[model samples]
Target: MEITFYQEVDSTNSEAKRLVDGGKAPGFAVVAKRQTAGRGRFDRVWQTPTGNLALTFAIPAPPSRPDLPTLALMTGLALHNVLQPLLGDRAQVKIKWPNDMLVNGHKVSGTLIERVGKVLYIGVGVNLVSRPENVPYETFSLAEVVNITVEELAEAVTAHWSATLAQWLETGFAPLCDDYNAHLYGRGESLRISLDRERAEWAEGTCTGVTPEGHICLADSEGHVTRYNAGDIDIIRTLQSV
Candidate 1:
């Protein structure tokens, strides 16, 4: 994989996309110490300090399950696997559905995968040193809790990603979902979900599991099942949400 490093950039996702568009081959990656206009899953701004990990890696192979958010889930699983050992066994490291990682319920990292014109860019941001304040949800940083460097974590994460990506491309989400669910944050709990984030039509259900196709499966109190396929939805944080 070819890598490009920058002291700062508007967005690694944007930079990587531009590079791939200009004929940069697959496996090209962009890394920045900081980003001026970094964005997350919903285009929410991501604030990264100099020591944080900001990267976007262009993938060579196409998605294994285009119907599922497989790339994001795989990225989260890889990160959890790598970060958990470093943080020690006592630290509670769990992965949120689609692509967010939490440390004891506070978000520490996020993943976003974008596909454009047969090319895929996996964008990831981790709060290795510091996290921005005034965010809507709780946040965490490794600097405050552990003795680790961004480079060290990056190397471990990328190695896991390479192997996981290969497995995903070879089989599909079925073979990966089991391990993925083992680290899931809100499994088998009462979940508060909003199919439409704009309004207050919140529904409560028992968080059963994720479908093979990537939709969140919820079995309501009435025994009816509900699956969310799209739109802004959040699992309302509860005392046991994580």
Candidate 2:
């Protein structure tokens, strides 16, 4: 668990990938104090203020070629565990499906996982001190509720990520489904899912717990449960005709 710190970088994930490309072994991390071009899932810009956390861990790809979605949820759960204690009754921390950490219904952190050859790059961005403003969705930062430095948060994240990865490798995601679902955001609530990136097609259902394979389950009015492998999910705050 060697962690290389950077004062500034284009992106920690990019730096981690570069290190692996240069023959660096797995089980190491790249953390940056600032990222000029940080990105979230689907290439969305992730604003990283100087005091926030931008980290990426390089790990060996699993031999069985595990499902990427399952791995992503696992990463989110790792982050959730780390933050839950720090937040400890301060506010509610829940994991939005796939990999987004929400606090009090606002996004606080997010995870991005990418595979490079035989290595996997798990990138995490947390709004430790300051969060981006004027974003499409609501956002929050740990600084608002707790006082913690970026270094401390980075250390905690890497440690938990390593432990969670080990458990996933030893057993599988099946055993952890309940744990993940327990902190799931919008559980048992109506959620709107956009089936395509274009947002032209949509599905609405009551949120059921995730399956062992890591797909989000949604139950329709007729009691039919459909598992979605990919989609953008959002909690429906107000009732509307769909």
Best candidate, TM-score-wise? 2
Candidate 1 collision pairs: none
Error of 2 at 164 (Å): 1.0
Predicted candidate 2 versus true structure: per-residue lDDT over 1-242, tens digit per residue: 89999989999999998888788898799999799999987798999979889999998887765565589889989999999999999899999887799998889998888887888898999999899897878899999999998889999988888899889888888888899999998889989888987767889899998998988889999989998988778777843211
Question: Against the hidden true structure, what lDDT does model 1 obtain?
Answer: 0.77
Give Cα distance to truth, residue 172, candidate 2, Å: 0.7
Runs in model 1 lying further than 4 Å from the true structure? 61-65, 197-200, 231-242
TM-score of each: 0.90, 0.96
Residues 36-155, model 1: lDDT tens digits: 888986677889888898988888656454644666777778888888888886678988786788998888998778878777889899998898798877889887778776666666
Q: Give the TM-score of candidate 1.
A: 0.90
Candidate with the greatest lDDT versus the true structure: 2
Local error of candidate 1 at residue 50 (angstroms): 1.4
